[model samples]
Target: MSRNAKINTLLLVLVAALAVLPLAFGLGDHKEEPFTGADAEAETAITEIDPDYEPWFSPLYEPPSGEIESALFALQAAVGAGVLTYYFGLRRGRRQGEARALARLRAEADADAGDEAASERRRV
Candidate 1:
Protein backbone atom coordinates (compact mmCIF):
# COMPACT_ATOMS: atom_id res chain seq x y z
CA MET A 1 0.00 0.00 0.00
CA SER A 2 0.97 3.64 -0.45
CA ARG A 3 2.31 5.66 2.51
CA ASN A 4 -0.94 7.62 2.88
CA ALA A 5 -3.01 4.44 2.84
CA LYS A 6 -0.80 2.89 5.50
CA ILE A 7 -1.08 5.98 7.70
CA ASN A 8 -4.85 6.12 7.25
CA THR A 9 -5.18 2.46 8.15
CA LEU A 10 -3.08 2.91 11.25
CA LEU A 11 -5.16 5.91 12.34
CA LEU A 12 -8.42 4.01 11.81
CA VAL A 13 -7.06 1.10 13.83
CA LEU A 14 -6.03 3.45 16.58
CA VAL A 15 -9.50 5.00 16.67
CA ALA A 16 -11.11 1.54 16.83
CA ALA A 17 -8.80 0.56 19.67
CA LEU A 18 -9.63 3.72 21.60
CA ALA A 19 -13.37 3.21 21.13
CA VAL A 20 -13.37 -0.47 22.07
CA LEU A 21 -10.77 -0.64 24.83
CA PRO A 22 -12.94 1.09 27.42
CA LEU A 23 -15.95 -1.09 26.64
CA ALA A 24 -13.88 -4.28 26.57
CA PHE A 25 -12.44 -3.60 30.03
CA GLY A 26 -15.77 -2.29 31.39
CA LEU A 27 -14.25 1.03 32.50
CA GLY A 28 -17.55 2.52 33.67
CA ASP A 29 -19.21 -0.80 34.51
CA HIS A 30 -18.77 -0.17 38.22
CA LYS A 31 -21.21 2.70 37.99
CA GLU A 32 -24.94 2.03 38.53
CA GLU A 33 -25.66 4.02 35.37
CA PRO A 34 -23.21 3.68 32.54
CA PHE A 35 -22.53 6.56 30.12
CA THR A 36 -23.99 9.25 32.37
CA GLY A 37 -23.47 12.84 31.23
CA ALA A 38 -21.28 15.39 33.04
CA ASP A 39 -24.36 17.44 33.96
CA ALA A 40 -25.74 14.63 36.12
CA GLU A 41 -22.37 14.13 37.77
CA ALA A 42 -22.01 17.89 38.33
CA GLU A 43 -25.46 18.03 39.95
CA THR A 44 -24.49 15.20 42.27
CA ALA A 45 -21.23 16.88 43.24
CA ILE A 46 -22.91 20.27 43.87
CA THR A 47 -25.65 18.73 46.00
CA GLU A 48 -23.05 16.83 48.03
CA ILE A 49 -20.89 19.92 48.52
CA ASP A 50 -23.82 22.29 49.23
CA PRO A 51 -27.30 20.91 49.57
CA ASP A 52 -28.87 24.40 49.62
CA TYR A 53 -27.41 25.46 46.26
CA GLU A 54 -29.94 26.77 43.74
CA PRO A 55 -29.61 27.03 40.01
CA TRP A 56 -29.78 30.39 38.23
CA PHE A 57 -32.43 29.06 35.88
CA SER A 58 -33.88 25.79 34.70
CA PRO A 59 -34.26 24.64 31.09
CA LEU A 60 -37.55 25.62 29.51
CA TYR A 61 -37.99 22.19 27.96
CA GLU A 62 -36.80 18.93 29.40
CA PRO A 63 -37.09 15.63 27.52
CA PRO A 64 -39.53 13.09 28.88
CA SER A 65 -36.93 10.33 29.01
CA GLY A 66 -33.19 9.80 28.97
CA GLU A 67 -33.40 8.43 25.42
CA ILE A 68 -35.16 11.57 24.20
CA GLU A 69 -32.66 13.69 26.05
CA SER A 70 -29.77 11.85 24.43
CA ALA A 71 -31.41 12.24 21.02
CA LEU A 72 -31.80 15.98 21.55
CA PHE A 73 -28.20 16.32 22.71
CA ALA A 74 -27.00 14.37 19.69
CA LEU A 75 -29.18 16.50 17.43
CA GLN A 76 -27.68 19.68 18.88
CA ALA A 77 -24.16 18.34 18.34
CA ALA A 78 -24.92 17.27 14.75
CA VAL A 79 -26.44 20.67 13.97
CA GLY A 80 -23.45 22.52 15.39
CA ALA A 81 -21.07 20.28 13.47
CA GLY A 82 -23.06 20.83 10.26
CA VAL A 83 -22.90 24.60 10.72
CA LEU A 84 -19.13 24.49 11.26
CA THR A 85 -18.65 22.14 8.33
CA TYR A 86 -20.69 24.39 6.03
CA TYR A 87 -18.80 27.52 7.11
CA PHE A 88 -15.40 25.93 6.62
CA GLY A 89 -16.38 24.40 3.31
CA LEU A 90 -17.65 27.75 2.07
CA ARG A 91 -14.44 29.49 3.12
CA ARG A 92 -12.30 26.86 1.41
CA GLY A 93 -14.38 27.05 -1.78
CA ARG A 94 -14.07 30.84 -1.89
CA ARG A 95 -10.30 30.59 -1.40
CA GLN A 96 -9.98 28.06 -4.19
CA GLY A 97 -12.14 30.21 -6.45
CA GLU A 98 -9.93 33.22 -5.75
CA ALA A 99 -6.79 31.19 -6.45
CA ARG A 100 -8.23 29.99 -9.77
CA ALA A 101 -9.21 33.51 -10.75
CA LEU A 102 -5.73 34.78 -9.93
CA ALA A 103 -4.13 32.01 -11.99
CA ARG A 104 -6.38 32.79 -14.97
CA LEU A 105 -5.53 36.50 -14.74
CA ARG A 106 -1.81 35.70 -14.66
CA ALA A 107 -2.16 33.39 -17.64
CA GLU A 108 -4.00 36.08 -19.62
CA ALA A 109 -1.33 38.67 -18.73
CA ASP A 110 1.45 36.32 -19.78
CA ALA A 111 -0.30 35.63 -23.14
CA ASP A 112 -0.73 39.36 -23.78
CA ALA A 113 2.96 40.04 -22.91
CA GLY A 114 4.03 37.21 -25.24
CA ASP A 115 1.98 38.69 -28.13
CA GLU A 116 3.50 42.13 -27.52
CA ALA A 117 6.99 40.65 -27.44
CA ALA A 118 6.35 38.82 -30.76
CA SER A 119 5.08 42.07 -32.38
CA GLU A 120 8.22 43.95 -31.18
CA ARG A 121 10.43 41.12 -32.58
CA ARG A 122 8.70 41.50 -36.02
CA ARG A 123 9.32 45.31 -35.97
CA VAL A 124 13.02 44.75 -35.18
Candidate 2:
Protein backbone atom coordinates (compact mmCIF):
# COMPACT_ATOMS: atom_id res chain seq x y z
CA MET A 1 0.00 0.00 0.00
CA SER A 2 0.99 3.68 -0.50
CA ARG A 3 2.55 5.74 2.31
CA ASN A 4 -0.61 7.95 2.54
CA ALA A 5 -2.84 4.88 2.84
CA LYS A 6 -0.60 3.52 5.66
CA ILE A 7 -0.75 6.91 7.45
CA ASN A 8 -4.56 7.02 7.16
CA THR A 9 -4.83 3.45 8.45
CA LEU A 10 -2.61 4.27 11.42
CA LEU A 11 -4.71 7.38 12.18
CA LEU A 12 -7.95 5.36 11.95
CA VAL A 13 -6.56 2.76 14.36
CA LEU A 14 -5.50 5.50 16.79
CA VAL A 15 -8.95 7.11 16.69
CA ALA A 16 -10.64 3.72 17.18
CA ALA A 17 -8.37 2.90 20.12
CA LEU A 18 -9.14 6.27 21.74
CA ALA A 19 -12.86 5.66 21.28
CA VAL A 20 -12.80 2.10 22.71
CA LEU A 21 -10.31 2.61 25.56
CA PRO A 22 -12.79 4.68 27.63
CA LEU A 23 -15.46 1.94 27.34
CA ALA A 24 -13.01 -0.96 27.91
CA PHE A 25 -11.93 0.52 31.23
CA GLY A 26 -15.18 1.88 32.75
CA LEU A 27 -15.52 5.65 32.16
CA GLY A 28 -13.95 7.66 34.97
CA ASP A 29 -16.30 9.79 37.06
CA HIS A 30 -16.23 11.92 40.22
CA LYS A 31 -18.69 11.23 43.08
CA GLU A 32 -20.07 14.13 45.11
CA GLU A 33 -19.89 13.79 48.91
CA PRO A 34 -22.57 15.20 51.22
CA PHE A 35 -21.60 18.19 53.41
CA THR A 36 -20.44 16.92 56.86
CA GLY A 37 -19.99 19.83 59.26
CA ALA A 38 -22.32 22.70 60.27
CA ASP A 39 -19.50 25.25 60.00
CA ALA A 40 -20.89 28.81 60.20
CA GLU A 41 -17.40 30.32 60.54
CA ALA A 42 -16.24 28.72 57.28
CA GLU A 43 -19.38 29.97 55.48
CA THR A 44 -19.03 33.53 56.82
CA ALA A 45 -15.38 33.96 55.76
CA ILE A 46 -16.34 36.50 53.04
CA THR A 47 -14.24 39.70 52.74
CA GLU A 48 -15.35 42.61 54.93
CA ILE A 49 -15.13 46.32 54.05
CA ASP A 50 -12.95 48.52 56.27
CA PRO A 51 -14.75 51.24 58.27
CA ASP A 52 -11.90 53.80 57.59
CA TYR A 53 -12.15 53.62 53.76
CA GLU A 54 -14.22 56.49 52.27
CA PRO A 55 -16.28 56.07 49.08
CA TRP A 56 -14.45 57.33 45.97
CA PHE A 57 -17.46 57.53 43.67
CA SER A 58 -21.25 57.87 44.00
CA PRO A 59 -23.44 55.13 42.49
CA LEU A 60 -24.79 56.41 39.17
CA TYR A 61 -26.87 53.47 37.99
CA GLU A 62 -29.33 51.04 39.58
CA PRO A 63 -28.98 47.35 38.51
CA PRO A 64 -31.69 45.21 36.86
CA SER A 65 -34.14 42.97 38.76
CA GLY A 66 -32.57 39.98 40.60
CA GLU A 67 -29.37 41.85 39.66
CA ILE A 68 -26.72 39.51 41.15
CA GLU A 69 -27.84 36.28 39.42
CA SER A 70 -29.76 37.66 36.44
CA ALA A 71 -27.02 40.14 35.49
CA LEU A 72 -24.39 37.35 35.62
CA PHE A 73 -26.57 35.10 33.39
CA ALA A 74 -27.16 37.93 30.91
CA LEU A 75 -23.45 38.79 30.82
CA GLN A 76 -22.55 35.12 30.32
CA ALA A 77 -25.08 34.74 27.48
CA ALA A 78 -23.88 37.90 25.73
CA VAL A 79 -20.23 36.87 26.03
CA GLY A 80 -20.96 33.34 24.85
CA ALA A 81 -22.87 34.57 21.80
CA GLY A 82 -20.18 37.11 20.96
CA VAL A 83 -17.39 34.51 21.22
CA LEU A 84 -19.30 31.89 19.18
CA THR A 85 -20.19 34.38 16.45
CA TYR A 86 -16.59 35.62 16.30
CA TYR A 87 -15.20 32.07 16.14
CA PHE A 88 -17.58 30.97 13.35
CA GLY A 89 -17.05 34.18 11.44
CA LEU A 90 -13.28 33.73 11.65
CA ARG A 91 -13.57 30.11 10.46
CA ARG A 92 -15.86 31.12 7.58
CA GLY A 93 -13.43 33.82 6.50
CA ARG A 94 -10.55 31.33 6.60
CA ARG A 95 -12.57 28.81 4.50
CA GLN A 96 -13.33 31.54 1.92
CA GLY A 97 -9.63 32.43 1.73
CA GLU A 98 -8.70 28.76 1.23
CA ALA A 99 -11.32 28.40 -1.53
CA ARG A 100 -9.98 31.49 -3.32
CA ALA A 101 -6.42 30.18 -3.06
CA LEU A 102 -7.52 26.80 -4.50
CA ALA A 103 -9.28 28.55 -7.36
CA ARG A 104 -6.18 30.62 -8.12
CA LEU A 105 -4.01 27.51 -8.11
CA ARG A 106 -6.46 25.73 -10.46
CA ALA A 107 -6.46 28.77 -12.81
CA GLU A 108 -2.66 28.93 -12.83
CA ALA A 109 -2.42 25.21 -13.59
CA ASP A 110 -4.93 25.60 -16.45
CA ALA A 111 -2.94 28.54 -17.88
CA ASP A 112 0.30 26.53 -17.68
CA ALA A 113 -1.35 23.53 -19.37
CA GLY A 114 -2.61 25.76 -22.23
CA ASP A 115 0.85 27.25 -22.71
CA GLU A 116 2.39 23.74 -22.82
CA ALA A 117 -0.23 22.54 -25.33
CA ALA A 118 0.37 25.61 -27.58
CA SER A 119 4.17 24.99 -27.44
CA GLU A 120 3.63 21.32 -28.34
CA ARG A 121 1.50 22.31 -31.40
CA ARG A 122 4.18 24.82 -32.49
CA ARG A 123 6.85 22.06 -32.28
CA VAL A 124 4.63 19.67 -34.26
Candidate 3:
Protein backbone atom coordinates (compact mmCIF):
# COMPACT_ATOMS: atom_id res chain seq x y z
CA MET A 1 0.00 0.00 0.00
CA SER A 2 0.96 3.61 -0.50
CA ARG A 3 2.34 5.79 2.32
CA ASN A 4 -0.84 7.90 2.46
CA ALA A 5 -3.02 4.80 2.66
CA LYS A 6 -0.95 3.39 5.52
CA ILE A 7 -1.12 6.67 7.44
CA ASN A 8 -4.90 6.95 6.87
CA THR A 9 -5.44 3.40 8.10
CA LEU A 10 -3.41 4.05 11.24
CA LEU A 11 -5.38 7.24 11.95
CA LEU A 12 -8.69 5.44 11.52
CA VAL A 13 -7.63 2.72 13.93
CA LEU A 14 -6.51 5.30 16.51
CA VAL A 15 -9.84 7.15 16.27
CA ALA A 16 -11.77 3.90 16.68
CA ALA A 17 -9.67 2.95 19.69
CA LEU A 18 -10.26 6.36 21.29
CA ALA A 19 -14.05 5.97 20.92
CA VAL A 20 -14.22 2.35 22.07
CA LEU A 21 -11.75 2.36 24.97
CA PRO A 22 -13.83 4.58 27.21
CA LEU A 23 -16.97 2.48 26.80
CA ALA A 24 -15.12 -0.83 26.98
CA PHE A 25 -13.49 0.09 30.29
CA GLY A 26 -16.71 1.61 31.73
CA LEU A 27 -14.97 4.88 32.53
CA GLY A 28 -18.14 6.73 33.63
CA ASP A 29 -19.73 3.88 35.62
CA HIS A 30 -19.58 5.86 38.84
CA LYS A 31 -21.72 8.68 37.47
CA GLU A 32 -25.53 8.58 37.89
CA GLU A 33 -25.97 9.65 34.26
CA PRO A 34 -23.00 8.44 32.31
CA PHE A 35 -22.15 10.13 28.99
CA THR A 36 -24.10 13.27 29.89
CA GLY A 37 -22.97 16.51 28.25
CA ALA A 38 -20.49 18.87 29.88
CA ASP A 39 -23.21 21.54 30.09
CA ALA A 40 -25.27 19.40 32.47
CA GLU A 41 -22.22 18.65 34.63
CA ALA A 42 -21.37 22.34 34.85
CA GLU A 43 -24.92 23.19 35.82
CA THR A 44 -24.89 20.55 38.57
CA ALA A 45 -21.62 21.87 39.94
CA ILE A 46 -22.85 25.46 39.92
CA THR A 47 -26.09 24.57 41.71
CA GLU A 48 -24.21 22.59 44.32
CA ILE A 49 -21.90 25.53 45.01
CA ASP A 50 -24.68 28.14 45.17
CA PRO A 51 -28.34 27.28 45.62
CA ASP A 52 -29.53 30.84 44.86
CA TYR A 53 -27.66 31.14 41.57
CA GLU A 54 -29.80 31.98 38.52
CA PRO A 55 -28.91 32.29 34.89
CA TRP A 56 -28.60 35.87 33.60
CA PHE A 57 -29.89 34.83 30.20
CA SER A 58 -31.94 32.03 28.67
CA PRO A 59 -31.71 30.16 25.39
CA LEU A 60 -33.50 31.78 22.45
CA TYR A 61 -35.11 28.45 21.68
CA GLU A 62 -35.17 25.21 23.62
CA PRO A 63 -36.05 21.85 22.15
CA PRO A 64 -39.09 20.16 23.63
CA SER A 65 -37.22 16.94 24.39
CA GLY A 66 -33.71 15.55 24.77
CA GLU A 67 -34.04 13.59 21.53
CA ILE A 68 -34.92 16.72 19.61
CA GLU A 69 -32.07 18.58 21.23
CA SER A 70 -29.63 15.85 20.23
CA ALA A 71 -30.98 15.80 16.68
CA LEU A 72 -30.63 19.57 16.36
CA PHE A 73 -27.06 19.44 17.65
CA ALA A 74 -26.20 16.69 15.19
CA LEU A 75 -27.77 18.65 12.35
CA GLN A 76 -25.76 21.73 13.27
CA ALA A 77 -22.55 19.70 13.34
CA ALA A 78 -23.29 18.10 9.95
CA VAL A 79 -24.01 21.49 8.34
CA GLY A 80 -20.78 22.92 9.73
CA ALA A 81 -18.80 19.95 8.48
CA GLY A 82 -20.37 20.25 5.05
CA VAL A 83 -19.51 23.96 4.82
CA LEU A 84 -15.87 23.32 5.78
CA THR A 85 -15.56 20.40 3.38
CA TYR A 86 -16.98 22.43 0.51
CA TYR A 87 -14.61 25.32 1.23
CA PHE A 88 -11.52 23.09 1.33
CA GLY A 89 -12.57 21.15 -1.75
CA LEU A 90 -13.07 24.36 -3.69
CA ARG A 91 -9.66 25.68 -2.61
CA ARG A 92 -7.92 22.44 -3.61
CA GLY A 93 -9.60 22.38 -7.00
CA ARG A 94 -8.61 25.99 -7.72
CA ARG A 95 -5.01 25.28 -6.72
CA GLN A 96 -4.83 22.21 -8.95
CA GLY A 97 -6.32 24.14 -11.87
CA GLU A 98 -3.79 26.96 -11.44
CA ALA A 99 -0.90 24.47 -11.35
CA ARG A 100 -2.11 22.75 -14.52
CA ALA A 101 -2.50 26.09 -16.29
CA LEU A 102 1.03 27.10 -15.26
CA ALA A 103 2.44 23.80 -16.51
CA ARG A 104 0.65 24.20 -19.84
CA LEU A 105 1.95 27.76 -20.24
CA ARG A 106 5.52 26.62 -19.48
CA ALA A 107 5.27 23.78 -22.03
CA GLU A 108 3.95 26.15 -24.71
CA ALA A 109 6.73 28.68 -24.04
CA ASP A 110 9.41 25.94 -24.35
CA ALA A 111 7.90 24.63 -27.58
CA ASP A 112 7.80 28.15 -29.05
CA ALA A 113 11.45 28.74 -28.09
CA GLY A 114 12.47 25.40 -29.66
CA ASP A 115 10.66 26.24 -32.90
CA GLU A 116 12.23 29.73 -33.07
CA ALA A 117 15.75 28.28 -32.49
CA ALA A 118 15.26 25.64 -35.21
CA SER A 119 13.98 28.23 -37.78
CA GLU A 120 16.95 30.58 -37.05
CA ARG A 121 19.42 27.71 -37.63
CA ARG A 122 17.64 26.73 -40.88
CA ARG A 123 17.84 30.38 -42.13
CA VAL A 124 21.58 30.49 -41.41
Model 3: residues with Cα > 4 Å off, grouped in runs? 1-16, 49-58, 117-124
- Regarding lDDT, does 1 or 3 come out ahead? 3
What stretches of model 2 exceed 4 Å from their correct place? 1-73
Worst 10 residues of 3 by lDDT: 31-40
Clashes of each: 0, 0, 0
Output the better candidate (1/2) by TM-score. 1
Per-candidate alpha-carbon RMSD to the true structure? 4.4, 10.5, 3.2
Best-fitting candidate, scored by TM-score: 3
Instruction: Give the winner by lDDT.
Output: 3
**In model 2, which range of ten residues has the least summed lDDT?**
29-38
Candidates in order, TM-scores: namely 0.62, 0.40, 0.69
lDDT of 1 by residue, 1-124 (tens): 9999999999999999999998899988999998787898999999999999989898998899989988999999999999999999999999999999999999999999999999999999
Give a tens-digit lDDT track for model 2, residues 1-124. Answer: 9999999999999999998886677554331332323463343332233545555786685555667757888899999999999999999999999999999999999999999999999999
Give the alpha-carbon lDDT of every model. Answer: 0.96, 0.77, 0.96
